[model samples]
Target: MSNLLPEEAEEKLVTVCRTAVGDSLRSLTYFNRFDYVQVYLREDLEQEADLNSFIGNEWHDFKMTQDAYRGSELGDYEYTIRVFENGYLVRITVEDFGVFVTTDGISMQDFEALAAATTEILDEWAIEE
Candidate 1:
């Protein structure tokens, strides 16, 4: 139940991401087929703690989706958040919000931070039209 339409929400999300991850952001891709937003980071960046936080949000959503007993609060939400030595991969779907962020040189802590930041940004975005 977001106040904004799907397209508006998507645009706001892209703006928020760009504002929050300015210099480190390498590219932004929006997949119309799946309504996915992809944010790629620079290869030389280092923000493991931030990135880890971001992944944690995805994990939370994943767990919610896996819980059969829980009501459909997430609504067709599904995701994959993977981290490795060189980079990390994230694919998420929550209602009309689907985002994928792939980055290089991420650590456990960084991933979590990134997830956390994204969650915060989305929360703020959700409040607006």
Candidate 2:
């Protein structure tokens, strides 16, 4: 794993995601000094009308738990994919940050491949990661 900066990672993610999702992607934002990339999508009919929507109805169920000092939810309906290269981390949240997926200990190429695959699954929306 090469030591990649957050900006570089963000660029790679955006490219991979764009190739995956095409024009529906809304925004990909970096938070905590690039520790995470919040991937937001437009709430359009294409997204809402899918019976098998990857991002499910529990989109707004995320909440910060005081006991665990973390966020928790109950379904995999929403999707979030987090990517990490070198030691930096990037989190891609889906549907109002509903689902959270985190990835670490991987090469840049592998990370890009993963992002591409995920984008492919989310073909209904555009991604700006």
Candidate 3:
């Protein structure tokens, strides 16, 4: 299992996303879990090839629309939640580091909420106090 706490993980994800997209972002709230938030970016599809390449020949169970790509991984003591950014067709992946999130794409408010939710869930499985 991961040693990091959810809060800590979330912080890490925010840093990574911000670094990639920047601090100013646009977002819309479309879905939510107890500690998770689903956001839609305001951007349009930019890189269709790059986005399609990520899901090439891979089996994915989408949660939203047919355009959405989703997957999960379960290990001996680790679990991961992955969501691909469909906005701007930016093939961004949000990974929960047992407590936080890591992703690529432009910054947006929706992304912030997603990062927060991912961290909250990871916190429950942290290996660190």
Candidate 4:
């Protein structure tokens, strides 16, 4: 698949995610130099689900982790999903940017479906370029 520059990817992610899960999607944050992204979804989930929340301010810690290991591929380019009582979060490194996700009250199944749809859009965007 063709790749996208971090800023380009971040823009696409915002559009894709908004279309995919606008209702449950709380916010989208991307850090290009740090290669970080976050997607926040509404949360109301059960334990042992395929996805889990990061408990407490782990999302903040996550940002710190990205800040700490900014330029290294091994340190920064990993995907993390955290499900908390209020919501869920998805963090990933793409190119030189990072993606973060947060949910306010969405179920696990719905969140996954929305995320899949968002990813599809990103893939398609890459191919188009």
Which candidate number has the best lDDT?
A: 4
Question: What's the C-alpha lDDT at position 101 in model 2?
Answer: 27
- Over the full model, what C-alpha lDDT does candidate 4 score relative to the true structure? 0.54
Q: Which stretches of candidate 4 lie over 4 Å from their true place?
A: 1-11, 33-79, 121-129
Q: What lDDT does candidate 3 reach at residue 98?
A: 21
TM-score, prediction 2: 0.29
* TM-scores, each model vs. reference: 0.44, 0.29, 0.26, 0.45
Name the TM-score of candidate 3. 0.26
Candidate 4 lDDT trough over 10 residues, lowest sum: 47-56
Better of 1 and 2 by lDDT: 1
**CA displacement after TM-score superposition, residue 121 of candidate 3 (Å):** 14
Of 2 and 4, which scores higher on lDDT?
A: 4
- Which ranges of candidate 3 are over 4 A from the true structure? 1-5, 27-129
lDDT of 1 by residue, 92-128 (tens): 4443344566654545555555555666655464465
| Candidate 4 global TM-score | 0.45
Count clashing residue pairs per candidate. Answer: 24, 7, 11, 34
Between candidates 2 and 3, the one scoring higher on TM-score is 2
Which of candidates 1 and 4 reaches a greater lDDT?
Answer: 4
TM-score of 1: 0.44
Residue 23 of model 2: what lDDT?
Answer: 47
